[model samples]
Structure formats: C-alpha cells, structure tokens
Target chain A: MTRPGGRSARVRDAVHEAVVELLAAGEIDAAIPKIAERAGVNPTSIYRRWGSRDHLLLDAAVTRLRAKSPIPDTGSLRDDLLGWAEGVERSMRDRRGQILLRALVATMAPDEEPVEYLRARGDDLQNALDRAAARGEPVPTVDEVLDFVLAPLYLRVLFRRPVEPGTAARLVGRLLTALPADPAPRAGRGG
Target chain B: MTRPGGRSARVRDAVHEAVVELLAAGEIDAAIPKIAERAGVNPTSIYRRWGSRDHLLLDAAVTRLRAKSPIPDTGSLRDDLLGWAEGVERSMRDRRGQILLRALVATMAPDEEPVEYLRARGDDLQNALDRAAARGEPVPTVDEVLDFVLAPLYLRVLFRRPVEPGTAARLVGRLLTALPADPAPRAGRGG
Candidate 1:
C-alpha cells in the first residue's frame, strides 16, 4: 500500500516513461502485466495509483506530453497570437504527438474522465490567453479564437496532410485583426 | 445478400427510423438488436452495411437528420454569409441533431471514417461559400472564412456550452466588415 510519493514515486515515473515508449511504438494493446514488469513495479501498484488500464495509460500520456510552452508576449496581441498559432502548427507536425492525440480521440468518450483531463489541457491553453487579456491586451473570447487558430493544425495532423507553412500564422493574423478592438467581456471571467 | 430496395428498402428505412427513436430515448446501445429485429433483418445485415455498432448508429442518425437547408444570396456577400452562419446556429440548436453529432464525436476517432464524414458535412457548408465566390461574388477563400465564422460554434459544441443567441450573426458581420474590399476591376478590359 505504498503511496504515490514515498518509494513509489520512482516506480510511478518509470511506469509513465514505459507507457510513453509503448504508445509511441504503437503498442497500445500491449499487455498490462508486461508494462508493470517493464517498469519493475508490481501490477498492484499501478492499479492502486491508477484505477484502470485506460486511466494509467491516459495519465502517462498526458503527463509526458503536457508541457505548457510559453505563449509569446509580443507588444502587439496580433503578433503574439500568431506566434502561438505557429507553435501549435509545429506541435501537430510531430508524428508521435499526432498519433497520441488521434488514439485518445478514438477511444475517449466526450463525457469520460480521460476526455475531461484532455480538455483540461485545452483549457490551460485558453487560460494563457485569458492571462494575456487580463494584462490589458485586446483579445477576443478564447472560444472565438480557439477553433480558427487550431483547426488547421488538427486538420493537417488528423487528415495526414502537410501543415502548410505559414497557414497557422496567417489564420492567427487574420483572426486577431478581425476581432473587435475590445471584445465583449466574458461572463464570470476567471483564469 | 439482398440489396436495400423495394421491400428491403422499406425495411431498412423502418430499422433506421427505429434506431433514431431509441437514440432519442437515450438508449443507443439497446437500439441495435431491436433495430434489426424490428426491420426483420439479421443484425449482421446492419453490421455489414454500417461496419460497427457506432457506425450503424451514426449513419442511421445522419439519415434521419440530414437536410438540404438553403444558403441565402441576398445580393450582398456579407448578408449571405451572415445568413449561412445563422442557419448553422439553428441546426446546432436542433436537439436531435446535436445528440447525433455528440454521439458521433464520442464514438469515432479523430481520423476515423465517421469523424471524417462529419467533417465533410462541415466542409460542405464551407463549399457553399466557395460556390458563391466562383460565381464572381466578392469574397476571400471560403475555407478561411469558414475557419473564423464557425470557430465559436464548434468550440461551444465541443466544450459543451450553449452558444449565445445572435453570436453567429454578429461574428459573420464582424468578419465581413473587417475584410479588405474587393479590388477594383481592371479598367478598359473589354473582352
């Protein structure tokens, strides 16, 4: 019954690392016992820390991939947003990340906890925009910009098309300039 | 194997109708065998036509819900685009249609055929704009306009929030006004 921290922290990190490797290698259906053995942890430890195989795998994937790379704070909001869009385009270009996202989308139900966790990551990205807006930067609601800025990247990755150079930046530039000088304040705004 | 025509067509229609009923009743999983039984066809027949359970359900849903709604051409491109946006907002507000879209998103992978089918539906809406442009209407790329115009709607649906009334029309209006005016036709270009 070791907790997540004590001696189990090392084991948990090892298990997470193993899951990422397996997922990247397209071994999604690899046996759970094999993962535990590879991580040098008892299967019970995994089950104790993560309730099910899906939860463990999803958590591992999220932890490994969830770096909040900073959004640029260029003097102009337009430039900053375009910069963020470029970053998104670059991330979607990574084959492993694309595969991971596609796998999650295929298996995760919209109402399920794993999907919620994935959405929380999306929310974190939106929160960064909100942070910028709170600093007196002119910007539209996160939802308004989210799809336009991100869809091309998702479309490219999911459809197996090349992310056309400058497409993301162009979209971000267009949307930012198109936004009203001051968007209507969001209801119940909070980061 | 009998094709869907004559009596078989009627039976297929009946089965698809029953599936819609079950889905509306929030019994998607229970609808499958019942649908086959009601249609007097083998469950395998449904599976054969639709591939998987989710596919069968979604195709049935789309069959029931598909509409050839009109896009307005009110002499002004801005007005026409705004009208189209309003139509999209209306369709998304349709309770049954929303349920079907939600179910499809939940069950399909981002790159899976079902998801692609849904994306194609969205793309068709964009294509209407393309058609208008090709008819010498003054507009930028339909794909670009679509990205901005539908951004908020998609975000709201995917994030499980109610879209604000008038938001669609306002977005379309804003985008139209923000766009650069059509370039003046080349002078003295008598064909």
Candidate 2:
C-alpha cells in the first residue's frame, strides 16, 4: 500500500506543484521534460504514472481547481450551490482558470475519460449535497447540479460567451426552482 | 473577394473533407503535414488559412455535425427541439461524433473561441426558435437552447458519461417547460 508522504506520493505532489508553477509562470505549453526537470523527477516515471502529458496536465489542473473551490457548507442547498457556482464562475473568468479549463478539454480522449477532474468535482458536489441533506433540506442529484448549473456556466466560459452580471445567481435560482427532489445523495452521474 | 466556388473555397472544402476522411479512417492522431499532403495542399498554405491543425479539425467536425443534424421545422418548438436533439444524441453516441466533439474541445483556447461550430449551432437554434415564435409558440432564447439542450448533451458524451435513454427528450422537455416567455429569439448566451 502506498503510504501518505511516501516516495511515490511525494513525487506526485512535487510534479503537480511544478505543473502549477509552470502554468502560473505563463508556460501553459510546457512539456513533460520541462516539468520533470522542475520537479526533480524522471520523465519516464511521470509517463509510467500518468500515461501522457495531457493526463498529467489535467490531473494538476483538477488539483488546483479543487484546492481553490472547496464545497461551501452554507447549511442550505440554495446558498451552498450559489456560492460554489459563483466561485466556479469567478475562476473560469480568470486567466489561470481559462488555462486549466483548456487543459481539461485538451486531455479529453474518446477512449479514455479524464478521471481527475470528474472525480474531484463529483465528490465536492456530493459533499455539498450530503451536508444539505443532513440539514433536512432537499438536494439535487450530482448529475442535476452538473447539468443544470455547472455545464451551462462552464460551457459559456469555454465558448467565450458573455457571462452577464449575476448570471451565476440567476442560473442557481433557476436550478433550485426547476430541478431536484432526487435525494440520491451520492447518486451516480452519467457513466 | 472570395467567391463561393473559387480556389479559396475549393481548397477549404478539400482540406475539410480530407480531415473527415482521416478521422474516419482512425487517424485520430494525424498531424497537419499529413493532412496537407492528403488534401493536396501545401502545409504552409494550411497554416496560413487555419492557423493550426486543431482549428482545421474543429472546422471540419462542425461542418459534419451541422450537416447531419439540420434543425427540424415541425411548426413547433418542442417537436423541433426533440427532433434535432435526437439527431445530436444519435450522432454523439457514434464513433465519428466522438472524434468531432474531441476536436471541438481541442480547438478551444482561452483567447481564441472556435467560431465554426458555435456559429452553425447558433443559427440552427435561431432558425428553429424563429419558426416557433412565428407559429405563436413561446420560444426560449437561443442561449437557453444552447445551454439546456446542446451543452448537456455534448458534455455528457465528451465526459464518457452514459447518456440515459431518452435523456435528450427529457432535456428538451425541461427546456420547453422550464424556460421561455423571453421571445428574444436571438438573445446571446453567457460568455
């Protein structure tokens, strides 16, 4: 079993950190060789662990995206989703967020689904919904939140559509009024 | 002045057809040089026209995606959307549609929004909504259709999520009932 803070874990962390640094430094196109060098890890090991540069890039982006936007526990489904959606909108409007999203799209393949972002986002949504459920409030399934709230916002940003002022709140409001009641707290999203 | 059937237009068609052929033949990883050669055009000319292979691929995919899924005119919003959404769903479930979507994402950048697909899809939606409005039916904005109908479908497919049977109909149903009364048929989607 891989221990916490073990060599493998450390290496992974270091590589992820390097990726973030590179991205922050405006090197969105940095290659694995450059990242491995920065992380002081072997590129070969990186390939062994992550499979491809796209995978590695996406994994790091997911980490950064999640690290910033922890699911808020506002004690109400409405407030929690609004907060999270606003955070998502803000990030997507920024330079780094745009790059991360681009990397997310870049990593996607027909045969292989990118796991890092989906798993992390799913867990975050589930955690928020679970908290709302425990507080005796109704909660939408993860899939509903994904489609109704997340997809619309993210799609708008990715396509460079104009995100009107307070659009996130509008979307959140519409979602709360329209969807939900599934209560399948950890219900599966699309496959 | 670029004429409809002039050299510029002909070269573009040839290159796009070449891209579709290569993708259909399982050359998903084919490069520009190869594409240019296959199209019987110089690689430099391709770079001059499209700026990148990703752009060319996306342009071609958009053309294909639009060509197959012409928006229906059933004299009503609900039926038209259902018909069109079904076509989109059927295509996205196939191998070629998968590649086309992948190419769509690949071409997306922070600064440069891919124009071909969005323009075509927007026009298709607008045409359908216009028809609906003319028939005295309440029509959701084109943005509404894009966010509710198109984004959900495409995102699910790209993420390898199982689009449950009849989900397209469900989304279209939600779109019709959940939104509308804003007869601004050409209202812009969020940026």
Question: Per-residue lDDT tens digits of candidate 1, residues A137-166?
Answer: 666655556555765455445444456678
Find the 10 residues in a row with the least total lDDT in model 2 chain A: A182-191
TM-score, prediction 1: 0.69
Please give the RMSD of candidate 1 to the true structure: 6.7
Native interface contact recovery, all models:
0.18, 0.41
What's the C-alpha lDDT at position B154 in model 1? 48
Stretches of candidate 1 exceeding 4 Å from the true structure: A1-13, A18-38, A53-65, A68-80, A103-137, A155-162, A181-191, B1-12, B18-35, B43-58, B61-65, B68-87, B90-99, B102-127, B134-136, B183-191
By DockQ, who's the top model here? 2
lDDT of 1 by residue, B20-131 (tens): 6666676756646787886678888787777777767667655554442345657666767777777767766666655565565455543443234444444555555555
lDDT at A9, model 1: 74
Candidate with the greatest TM-score versus the true structure:
2
Candidate lDDT values, in order: 0.61, 0.78
